[model samples]
Target: MTNNGNKYLAGAVSFAVFAGVVGPAAAVSWTPPGVTMGVPLGAAFAPGIYVSNLTHYGDGPDKSITADVPAFTWSTGWKVFGASYSAVVIPEVLKVQNKVTSKDFAGIFSPLLIPVSLSWNLGQGFFVSVGEGIYFPFDSDVSFTTSGQTSGWAAETRVAFSYLKDGWIVSANTIYGVTTADDIGRRQPNYFNVDWTVARTFGKWQVGAVGYGAWDLEETVTNAAVGKGHIVGVGGMVGYDFGGSKLLLELTRAVEQGGATNYSRNDTHVWARLTFPIWKPAEPGEEHTALK
Candidate 1:
């Protein structure tokens, strides 16, 4: 890779903070699956402004969604409890289709704001990080918007850990989310999900296997507590460093659909991500992670 530092930033933010997929039924968690592939979890970052552009296409029975997401991260020199602190914000444009209804809906989805992101290095290439974020709805009503807009506002917590040393990148990130009742008198089920990655760096290329799963934690309007619905997908990722930026491509196929109830679980997802630094200080901030 042209720059090991910049190459890994793609890994650190692969989890896209708070992108969710919704279907006719409360298929699963609000957060989409496989959003964390291609990158390591909680990679230590150098103080700077970094940006990522992602285009995601998802398909399922009777429904599909295409999303354009732009995210900005700031690794500030600020410290929180001995850990380097960072913040991220994301906005999205969505195109959703209902194959059965033969109708397409397009609009902006709720934006995600992560105000508290803290990463701590435990040495030996191991790191732990935590973040708190909110998926706040826009003031205007999007009643015509597809489920891609989700039911209402959501609050989520992110916890991540990564092993980045030598030429190996292994990591896991988890999100636990709960939503408030929407204006329509419905609330998404409380949910838990995880994204995991295992990759090896070879020169300028990184290849790995990635997967994610989501399960409901409580009953919702459409589901019973005994047989709650879930979603799971497994895929592969390939990434490369281009000196000026990093590029990652990922493909994931769903392995489980919530039986005949949640059709959105049976689908395919693809992602193309590009990450680059916008500004860097003359005296670069130290990479909080120490690689021996």
Candidate 2:
């Protein structure tokens, strides 16, 4: 793993310099692009529609960009409801350039993810959530791997806490991976991540800062074979909430790469997302309705 880290660092530097003019989209956010993957546990599920794009670079075999949509569902009381479907698609150019020749690659390989998670309010602004998910490689190319790509299963778990004070809010979340594509000969190791966000609102405008970190518990790849890797990222965002609709724009940078320097070796990534209410709101005269 040590050797792989050194090699990855060298490759990462060369790649960064070669691609010197780091594009605007690359600095969008330090976290995963979707609201589902970033959602805090125990939050009420409000039916809505969301669209997002996630692009990753630096790692030789791990470079990819995926665009996705999240379809939300809610149960009565909203206390114990779950999300059923979520998916993503990758454009063609990225597939060809990265030598991601195979559709059956591992580690951020799939274009879609189906997650089923439940959130519960523990009272007093704190909450707990737990869920499971599957990664489906619907349009992958098996022969794309020059060294052979890996495609298989991935399992995830999430836990979090959130608080609202005055007009400001804060949330902390942690995600853990138990099993993945390792069965298919890929070294996808276990990992844990923490995400924190501080937000406030004024009029119809919402603003906030997001900070997060990740640690690899096991080294499934050579670069991560030794001690776990660490990564710290921070970004700022502003959004508009129009009673029933919301749109947000964000910019983030990776300030530190602890061990996965080869994997997420870049200094920054740019991102943005737009979300809309797919469901009609209750009549203005109606009170805030709670769905179970």
Candidate 3:
């Protein structure tokens, strides 16, 4: 879950925007920025939940193990301005299954992370969303490694944006480690990312191709010590509609970053979710005719 791409802030913004305008159209799936076309607005809203399992293999001297129950409940709805908003709560664990052998031994812990975001649908195929939330380091075991010792607690700030058109979508997202928990005395600087996708829909099916990457910025060193920093990833998703609800299945590979010694090869992960309508469809306005 420490991968900047998996950060709560960026993911939440992506989901909110997709659910608001995309409707039940599938194929392009959650493929951001490159798959927008003929999408309507303000058609859905209801509280739902999402669960995902992620496995990351870093390329370096250290081995990482991130196995946990990462689930979030969301309450989302549309705005009168053709915008959308959501609130989420997620708790998960991170562990170092295999280290470099020469490092001091400590333990792993689970933390509670929450994110809230609001996106504005800027009519005629343009949209944007911005949000701020806290990652409370409630886990006693999550820590900082320095000078043969371990520490705890890290706080972060997040921001994300996306633009849409008939056949393309462009997006950029970033997170900043602005503050630290009491156990960890200092906070790092910034971590950022940019991703783009292009796609088209055919009836109930949509197809898209995508590529994205992340990098460290400012005082932040991209977590090089524990084996992190810079990434290039490419992937795609296929979607289908089951009438009342829609389903999306996705695949992605991490091309670089996540280790200190060796760069990991095409590490893969999958995502799936179900979305339902929260409200009844609005009635179409009647056509006006002059009395003959």
Candidate 4:
């Protein structure tokens, strides 16, 4: 809401799915990136319920993956330790197809839960926040997760910061994740991703450059030769507010890649997000800060 009388939400949720293949035909991935970008973390959403649908489609390395992720968020008027609090949950679906044949290969469910998120507005347009997320695999074929099977749980800790003032926004978020071993004792490597966004919102239109870097810190437990996967990409983002709803579109192409088995080093990602409020307090002003 760039032009909503200089207003912005305190915190919300966003998500996507990634499946890459770089050098070899190895394993599959279910890493969802870009959850807390394009907004100030220290701001507050009006105390109410909001929902979003995030879609990610990537076609590369002989395969294509499409993920439609649905999320529900609850913004509270309550505050703890001088920060606004929120919670979110996402239940996602992953569909994979062959690029050449255009036929379905695999599909499964991967879900995420963020029971805690807090944002702190530090005056002068500076905001910071912290959150924790848990990911679960409902099926063994969940995006063909991990080296072999995906029967264990995973945890992620993330932090976000932003500076929003005068229609200008500079924001960044970090994610560090660790996964437990599968049923067969095969563990996916620990991973880290950083999302950086810089945009200017004017007259209900927002445009900016967005980029991210993702790296797997350890090799697959059973594949000693598979080392790790790492890639970086930069792209453009455009957003517009239509009445009470907002839509954001982003496209990024990998500019660097190396040492990956199931990760496509050279890949492109097209992500879209649609967000709107499901319900809100009648006197939003009493529970909402409106803007940071």
Candidate 5:
């Protein structure tokens, strides 16, 4: 019989072992400046920080987990051949606690995630983006289970589209992910994620509703007619644009789930992101200087 034990362990380990553990909301929460996925901001650099708090409450009272993550991100982009290309790197610190056991695990300098993407403006308020991301296990020694340590790489590809007109914004982003096998020869099932947002702008502030869902594509080892991993969430988001800087806040609650999913019922997630331009292109006839 296929051992299903590793599947549960993989879920928990993936959360605690990776830097992107902000929660399911993190998978689809970010919207690039201008809320246009296909329009490329030219020759700019942005360095920002994000802080997230996530709480997970399983069906059993002893299954509660809480985590706080502080992440630092750097992004740079340039225009290329009528398309925009950008890359981002994120590194994070993790602090997770088990409410029932009162046990805490603090991880410093977790894995790093690098994503590279290219976008094209399809004109008439339509845009498209295609990108891939990779996660490098920088802290491979940390283990969430006694069965084995977590050490592996992950990779994913994403496609996104958006429409913007008259201060109204609508977009959808999707991702597919797979990971390498762990020391115990257990591999995480391939998964698909979908995220969407709809918002209207009022001067400098934009308000919207956001939703996300994830589903595992493969069946579990036992083939016990159990549904694959699945979870869904919905929330509200607000943002303000300040010239070259922007601030965004979002809160979401898990509304649906399958037994094999990683999230808990009624799980809550809160996220805050601030981004500011570090470098900007020169204006017409402007002198190029390091200070500028």
Candidate 6:
């Protein structure tokens, strides 16, 4: 099989075995920031843990796949050059199963690292951010030659915009990712992904609708046309904030997909974030104070 075909087959088998694990197509964007629009206050930092269970029912030539992922993330922010900068690190483990091939794959995958991000509050409830990250495979067990895996090293750039005011929030995030060519001289095409959310907050609870779409930006090494690999998803989200922590639940259905793409027809996600102040600026009208 050509590298492009192998990549697609790997995705198909991934969905068939692990029920749609968090692969390249799904991991391009960061989690939604919810209703917050401005930079973090008082030296914000947090260590968060997340667990997601996903099951995918394939269309076309693929079968069912289910997988569970447990992740640990550390996020922190600081002010630099009058703008807010943040960093995040996430490590995850994947446990997956393929019913069609009667095969099971379980191991750690590449960790996601976003070491640099800058944000600005543009006033009038508008905010913007830009960042870059990389997916570097450290686990030898995770390989493109594997039934449920694809390309090794990949890099991504992300941009986001949000408006928040009067208990209403709207945001959009977009990412562009490029994968390195494999040993076989086969390369997966570059891809672009975008996600949008609109939500309203009532007291400590927020409800909203979310949608996402992804498409290839360039032709495959085999000359397959760009845009032939695409997927669209729509879903609802509900969340609650408890001062120092937040919990969110989302359920989405894949409304459209191309045969070459590896995506589930449906999926559910849950996220929990816990934050605490590690440093704080001096109070208004106060003299210079060290972080406390």
Q: Please write out the lDDT profile of model 5 over residues 120-175, one tens digit for every residue.
A: 66767666777777766443323321233454566777787777667767777777
Candidate 1 regions with alpha-carbon error over 4 angstroms: 1-25, 139-151, 221-226, 259-265, 288-292
Candidate 5: stretches off by over 4 Å: 1-14, 17-81, 108-112, 140-150, 221-225, 284-292
| Model 1: lowest-lDDT 10 consecutive positions | 1-10
Question: How does residue 222 of candidate 2 score in lDDT?
Answer: 40
TM-scores for candidates 1 onward, in order: 0.83, 0.63, 0.55, 0.82, 0.71, 0.68
- Model 4 alpha-carbon miss at residue 209, Å: 0.6
lDDT of each: 0.65, 0.41, 0.36, 0.63, 0.47, 0.47
Task: Please give the lDDT score at residue 178 for candidate 1.
Answer: 80
lDDT of 6 by residue, 32-134 (tens): 2111211122121222222222222222333232323322223333466655666655454444443445555555455668787666667776777777888
Q: Which candidate leads the pack in lDDT?
A: 1
How far does residue 34 in candidate 2 sit from its true spot (Å)? 8.5
> For residue 202, what is the lDDT in candidate 6?
90
Per-residue lDDT for 1-292 in model 1, tens only?
0111110000111111112232222434545556666556576567888888888988776567787788788889778898889899977776766565565655565678989889988889888889998888553222212233333677889999899888888988899888765544445567788888888889888889988877777743332223465767889988888875888898888787562124355688888988888986888766742111
Which portions of model 3 show Cα errors greater than 4 Å?
A: 1-83, 93-96, 99-115, 140-157, 163-171, 181-189, 195-197, 218-228, 244-246, 256-292
Error of 3 at 125 (Å): 1.6
Candidate 1 clashing pairs?
A: 11-39, 11-40
Residue 149, model 1: lDDT of 39
Worst 10 residues of 2 by lDDT: 17-26
For candidate 6, the per-residue lDDT at 5 reads: 26
Q: Number of clashes in model 5?
A: 0
Model 3 TM-score, all chains together: 0.55
Residue 29 C-alpha lDDT in model 5 = 14
